[model samples]
Target: MTEVLFYHLQNMALESVLPPLLEKSLERGWRVVVQSTSEERADALDAHLWTYRDDSFLPHATWRVADAADQPIILAIEEGNPNRAQVRFLVDSAAVPADADGYERMVLVFNGDDADALAAARAAWTDCKARGFTATYWQTDERGRWQRKN
Candidate 1:
């Protein structure tokens, strides 16, 4: 069964929160696929991944890039997993793919301040549960740390 994690972004932006989570996934030797709502969003994240930290590097490529299959991390606006990623990240109202069970884990990150995002996240949470996925919700605390809400 796939494990689903929902991240309710409050104090910090997705840029601040995503890198650390990606790092943890990489540490576990898991390839990752980041899904964005649009090509523009995926392009922005592709650039952010390279410069998020001056001292660190997260090797990743956009789906349009030539060597996508060779990358451990892939950024795409679609649902395909060209990199054989074990983890899939859905952000900015990206829809969860119907074939999501292929991945070991699925993560949904939404800004709490956005009413549309909040509603979509809630629907995704409920849908995941109905699909028999083990779902977990995480929220940012006062110190900007993640804590499981349920």
Candidate 2:
């Protein structure tokens, strides 16, 4: 069974939140594919992940790269998993991919401030549950700690 997680971002930006999660995923030896809504956003995330922190380094490439299969992380706008990742991250309001069941986990990170994103996340949660996934919801507390809501 696939474990689906819904991360609800309140005052924080995706740029601030995503790198740490990706790091954790890598620490667990899981290859990742982060899907965005557009090529521009994917490009921006590709750049941000490189310099998100001075001490941190995320080995990644866009899906367009010839050696994408060699990267641990791949940023893409489309649905295919180029790196044979065990985990897939849906960001920037990207919808859940059709191949969601292929991964060990599927993470949907949505901006709480954006109405469309919030609605989309809700819909995705319902869809995941209906698909028989073990769905969990998380929200940040006052000090920026993740608290499981359900």
Candidate 3:
């Protein structure tokens, strides 16, 4: 079973989607491990989650690009998922939380219809993949929905 962190809303803003998704995941039936930029998002989703007391938030520390060993996977989600990770995640994608999990081999998504941003993002995804990680295009529909390239 794949653990998924679904980030969605009528408007798709962090403030709008984070709370309800947390609540939905906490019905006590889902066993998905979520990671967000901070515990604030987690706490906002579920009160039982590990959050910092008095507003500090349950974060070990933020991740920095300075550490070469732990590079992040890149994904451009049509609609990003919710996260409550204890560390700050660096993002280059418009979808803040990336996917359910970062990939050892990335399954990159692109809007081939866009023609320009697609080309650039594809290049970036390719560079990461070339370093022994997997990369390929998952073309999107006209409304920016994902349909894996078969």
* Candidate-wise lDDT, in order: 0.92, 0.93, 0.32
Q: What RMSD, rounded to one decimal, does every model reach?
A: 0.8, 0.7, 11.3
lDDT at 133 for candidate 2?
Answer: 97
Cα lDDT tens digits, model 1, 48-82, are 98999999999888998888999999999988989
- lDDT by residue (56-129, candidate 3, tens digit) is 33221122224312322111123332232222212122322333234222222223345553554555555444
TM-score of each: 0.97, 0.98, 0.28
The 10-residue segment of model 1 with minimum total lDDT is 141-150
Q: What stretches of model 2 exceed 4 Å from their correct place?
A: none
* Cα error, candidate 1, residue 48 (Å): 1.1
Q: Write the per-residue lDDT of candidate 2 for residues 1-150, one digit (tens) a residue.
A: 899999999999999999999999999999999999998899899889999999978899999999999999999999998999999999988988889999999999999999999999999998998999999999998989999995
Q: Return the clash pairs for model 1, or none.
A: none
Error of 2 at 2 (Å): 0.7
Q: Model 3, residue 147: what's the lDDT?
A: 49
Q: Is candidate 1 or candidate 2 better by lDDT?
A: 2
Top lDDT hit: 2
Candidate 2 residue-wise lDDT at 80: 95
